[model samples]
Target: MRFDDIDARMRVFETNHDHCVLPGLYIVARIDGRSFTRLTRERHPFEAPYDPRFRDLMLETVQHLMNCGFQAIYAYTQSDEISILFHPNESSFSRKERKFISILAGEASARFSLSLGDVAAFDARISLLPSQNLVIDYFRWRMEDASRNCLNGHCYWSLREEGISAGDATQQLKGMSNPQKHDLIFARGKNFNDLPSWQKRGSGVYWQEVSVSGVNPMTGQEKNTARRSLVTDIELPLGEPYEDLLASILLDGVANRSPILEDVK
Candidate 1:
């Protein structure tokens, strides 16, 4: 067989089932740390439940992903997972599902591992939302989940500090109501409401234009310029307000002007 014929024949196996996200749909990538429980608790001496160091590492990873060659509009991180909302018209890799999954997972894992000075892995899945409302609901879903995780984590760690066995702590919280869990932590002199908002609602990253004041070298005159930059928001709002925020980002003129999905395959 000719070289070109052989190359084409072999490429089919790799590309045969390649799936691309449909046009006009919203693409969100949910990337999660793999086996992070062992990685954080057993291997590393990270503080229990939540650690500022770990949180900073996660924030850096999110910031990296936002700028890593994709038109990511927003990103949310809580616990060991990060969810990214892409611009509706993103055309990277022809919007191929596998490409997004593999590259995002690889990038997150590599970035996080390098930052932590240890090997850590992450897996990613793409969610194809058909409407803007669904995109809002998707992030709302994650925010609520972060609330639950935050409550549960505080409760668990409080019990553990009192020398409760891991199995016993798990059993104790198994069927407890949210109010009951809050009471459990409150009894230990910690108010659930007083915990950091970032721990409860997760953090978000988005692009914003800021006015930068600079001196012009040629004219030696002060000037104000608009520059686009990423804003890491640890104090995210909740419920309807959060939904409104996502809607605003989606409706931003810059987001609307992003590149449309191209026919690259």
Candidate 2:
């Protein structure tokens, strides 16, 4: 049979679920060679925190996950490892949990090994929650971890090296304005270009539209208006390596707990 024919059969079997596929949370773990850090530190010393080149590489990896049919994926980088959050009901990898994890890990490992001259690996786990409250709590825990470890993060260290003060640095945190802490965590250390393409222009959360008439014809129709997502301008703690901070969060602390699966098929 042809490739398309085989794919059709596979989809039929994959989605032939007898029960409802409940919505829940998933934890994606991505690991890469330590050599990447050494190389990056050498190449771009100043812009290390929000380096576009590095962010682009990670973005490509996240895009790979998206293309595989995952939705609502939020990716954050702490040096080589990337953590992604995926919405429930995404079964791009044949609806087999193990297959999905392996596919992501394999793709990330190969891509990083080829592009950065270092070996990489990936692993993932899913935690099903009965309610949205649990999801909120989980994210709140991560944000608190970020806040507690901010001083030791790579971006923070870089700022200190440049003579920035601790107080001033704290004020620069992107999304910590309110006294009441929330569950959602901000993706810190991203620069202007790191944002979705539409968010690059203007300042302070605004919307813009492209007029199709004046734009390049080959680029497609231009009567499109897009609203940029709100992004925080938080900075990391000074004088700490990014990798170490990530390890503290993922490996040493609460993230190490057993995966919580609640009624997800």
Say which candidate scores most in lDDT.
Answer: 1
So what's the TM-score on candidate 1? 0.95
Q: What's the CA RMSD for each of the models?
A: 4.4, 14.8
Instruction: Kindly list the per-residue Cα lDDT of model 2 for residues 82-112, writing each as its tens digit.
Output: 4454444444553455555566677776776
How many angstroms is residue 77 displaced in model 1 relative to the true structure, after the best TM-score fit?
Answer: 0.4
Pairs of residues at least 3 apart in sequence or in different chains that clash in candidate 2 = 150-237, 151-237, 156-236, 156-237, 156-238, 157-238, 157-239, 174-233, 174-234
lDDT of 1 by residue, 1-265 (tens): 8999999999999999999988899999999999999999999979989999999999989988887889988899999999998887889999999999999999999999999999999999999999989999999999889999999999999999999999999999999999999889999998988899999999998876666789999999999977666788888987888888888888873444643322111
Residue 137, model 1: Cα distance from true site in angstroms: 0.5
Runs off by more than 4 Å, candidate 1: 253-265
Q: If candidate 1 were superposed on the true structure by all CA atoms, what would the RMSD be?
A: 4.4
Residue 262 lDDT (model 1): 25
